[model samples]
Target: MVDADASPPQAGEPISEQEALRRLRQSEDSSQQYYGAWWLGRMRSQHPEAVPLLQQALRQRRPRDSGDGVEENAVARNAARALGKLAPAAQTAIPDLLDTLQDADDGLREAAARALGQLAASEAIEALCEKLASGPAGAGAQQANSPRLVEPCEALLEALGDIGVNEPRVLAVVKPFLEHERPLIRSAAARTLLQLSGEARWGELLVDLLDHPQLQVRRAALMDLGAAGWRPGFQAIAATLAENSLKLMALRGLVEQGNGDPGDEALLACMDALL
Candidate 1:
């Protein structure tokens, strides 16, 4: 729901709010239902029935094939995602989303975790912590000591980070992921720890990731640092191999987090250099 660059659903032409709701409920076309749910969230529809309708969709268990049998994405995934965009209003969805955390489908679990995070459901903190109990990944372990749900675990880390929980358990659950085999997950851990602890070591780990062999990892590091609002990450972000525009975007985020100080001319100089 909070994805900065996620494209709108391409199901079909736009329709009136009533039409969208009608399709979601009474229409025979399931794809139309999916699009309707997406539209409601994209527009943040204020209709009283919007939240309830989406919740029903989230509870639905149907295979989503794109008119072809080749793909198997679930309709419920999008429904859950839409609810995240309509949070507080969607507070009724907390228990349902929690149940989804244990759902068999990895995609569903990932979407639910992301939604719970966007809603800032503090009640979800304990439930999310359980998924991360992978026995910890030490710098020497080379991999997680216990197996973890690959993408789902990463999504869980991202959710906890976004929730901005300051409890010791939140920090404890995430710190071990610094040694995760994947760079994005490692940086995600660093991002959360940096935000929660304000520790330079975590930021330094993110800085180290700027030079990772994988280009995607480098980009993830840039955005993670920006989201953490660590002012000192500017130089490393500017030096990363991502597109010029993203580098500037990252620098702009750091500037917002930077405290006003005429003495911090060097930071301003870096922003000027990016220009």
Candidate 2:
């Protein structure tokens, strides 16, 4: 069990906001871990200085030594989680949050990426799309190469979908995932694309997914289309709702999207049949 009152800062020597901020800026992972804990503790305080310190900590870049030299920093991850707890008023953190997607440390990169999604900032759409287009490494050469980076990239893609911002660049970034070797990556990309694109594009893209050998991939694509709320996607959902194998998933998407009104009676009927 953790002691809540253990190690409370001594009076007068209580950790200064500047020291916390400086420690957060350290590029060393060890320093980040130390300061990250300090920042988390500070967040619970009602001190007038707390908010700005938290905001700065969130903006601080993560240590660079971890694998996937871009966006994988532990410091960045802790900062993002902290910022999410301070959200709404933490809107000012959005730009920094978006910038974090480009971090060299995959952990930090993904953390920032995920935090932005939680914030759901419309302003981040363009930048997210831009990052997706260039890939997580940004426009420069990538130093770290590892399979671990894919997970963060996948998480970033999912966040983009949840945020629901549409941009042609984002579509282009998502389009290639339909054929990715990793089913999870394919599923995330397909879902994000379905949310950001219209029916025509979704229908065309989903057709490709329907033929995919992986059952999970096919189901994910169908589910994405059904819940996408575009006319073309609705039509695709209607057509697939009769297939015994795909029907349940298609209907599930519709119900989840709250498209069960009188206007969607046909969809609801189809969903009932599937269930």
Candidate 3:
């Protein structure tokens, strides 16, 4: 009974799965289509058709003005993100998502990398490595470009970590990133290195990053430690100067990784005073 032409609800307004799919597949308006895809993924749509429809949207990488040089395909990027969220269900979309890693669009590439990571598409290890090195010229390229020291896709580091590719070559490529100009990238390298190698040095570096001057950097380090579930950084994460909610999220992430429990001193201290 709902009219497709109805003015869309507020950006974050809740809508049924069917309505979301309707907007994504049937709407003529680009914003509607984008929002619809976003809603499906954000709501974690359980529709049997969600995967196929999102796969279809994934190929419509039509270029749109990004104000920056990067031509973005917002719809396709959103689809990629949604597919990642629907992983195991979207497992069949792995090849399609893998193809997107070579995309010219940085945003799409980043989204695809994140999706592949969540999927843990081990087959994607080499392709991800190739793209990761594209930022410069493999190891040398990282800081080679002035003003942009890290790989263009910072998420690539996390995706690699998430995928847990621990080959020596992979370690060699990721290690160089630790010295990149950006502290966030450094921390991501730290996380990847830590996960793959289980090295105490990398975890120690992450703990140091918790003290980074930038708020976002500190936040990134917080989550990275949580993702790493690096037990050594537990107290530092609790003590780091980030928002209380962010700190709690990191602690909970660590706990979920089996690093500790709510009764643990760090989580206990953080919960009592959410700074």
Candidate 4:
């Protein structure tokens, strides 16, 4: 008799590892619903039985309904995340993950996108770019029916920065967000541009953000510009110092980027007063 709670056998039994793998492959459940997929992914080394099962699970369609409701979807997401741990070796899973990017469920889509980035799958760059181009703005004011979508998009954007893929596409996708009505989106966009600024395309864009009406936006842009070695951004930083609350950040930006000359001394005095 099979023990209900016994960990699925690690070796031969009535169900041959190969046959069990085939069953998992043929299962109708979406890749996202199978908890066993993640387990198999992690055990690929200790248990040779794991690899084929994970690959099969990755090929399965997303679940229409997870038994546990919210937690059900976590199964698929964990599977992708596990595959990410398998990374370059898990390259075969990239296409399936990319397909998940099209899922209507924002969280699932975001998870899959982030996993692709983790895998550093260059093939995903164009699809990620397209998603960013047409996706809803991350700003709080955009009125999304699903509030959770924003973080996933933000995560996908950040992952692009980490993988160093799609420089032009990333800039193009993020440019529109710089004008977003929500400060959160604006901040996220500014930060991403800062991370990718070594390419120089973001320099002009960061400088422009100095003029944003929100003080927070201006502050974030200042920090990014200063870090990127954009000396020209100092003038805007100096102007911001007139606001006592903003003086410290302005002073920091200056000190970090300035040439340490007479202009910097004057700015230091102004910052002292606000301190």
Q: Residue 43 deviation, candidate 1, in Å?
A: 2.3
**Residues forming the 10-long window of minimal summed lDDT in candidate 2:** 1-10
Off by over 4 Å in 4: 1-51, 60-71, 135-144, 181-184, 199-275
Structural similarity to truth (TM-score) of each candidate = 0.81, 0.54, 0.85, 0.52
Would you list the C-alpha lDDT of every candidate in the order shown? Answer: 0.75, 0.58, 0.75, 0.57
**Pairs with backbone N, CA or C atoms under 3 Å apart (clashes), candidate 3:** 137-141
Error of 1 at 215 (Å): 0.8
By lDDT, the better pick of 3 and 4 is 3
* CA error at residue 39 for candidate 4, angstroms: 5.5
Q: What are the per-residue Cα lDDT tens digits for candidate 1 across 123-162?
A: 8999888888763442213324434444476678878987
Top candidate when judged by TM-score against the true structure: 3
**Candidate 2 per-residue C-alpha lDDT over 1-275 given as tens digits, one digit per residue, 9 for 90 to 100:** 01122232233345655565555555565444445435654454344454465556656554575456444444446666656555566677787777776666666666666667767777766766666665434422233665464436565676787677786766777676555656656656766776766445544666566557776666666655555543335455555423555656565555566442434666667666655
* Candidate ordering by TM-score (highest first): 3, 1, 2, 4
lDDT of 3 by residue, 1-275 (tens): 01112233354667789888888887467677788878877777889989898898898885556575533377788888888888689888889888888776656777888888888888888887876664434532544435443334467777888899799878877877787766877888898898888888998998888888888889988888788777667678878998878777777767676353334675666656764
The worst-scoring run of ten residues by lDDT in candidate 3 lies at 1-10
Superposed Cα RMSD, model 2 = 9.9
- Would you list the clashing residue pairs of candidate 4? 32-76
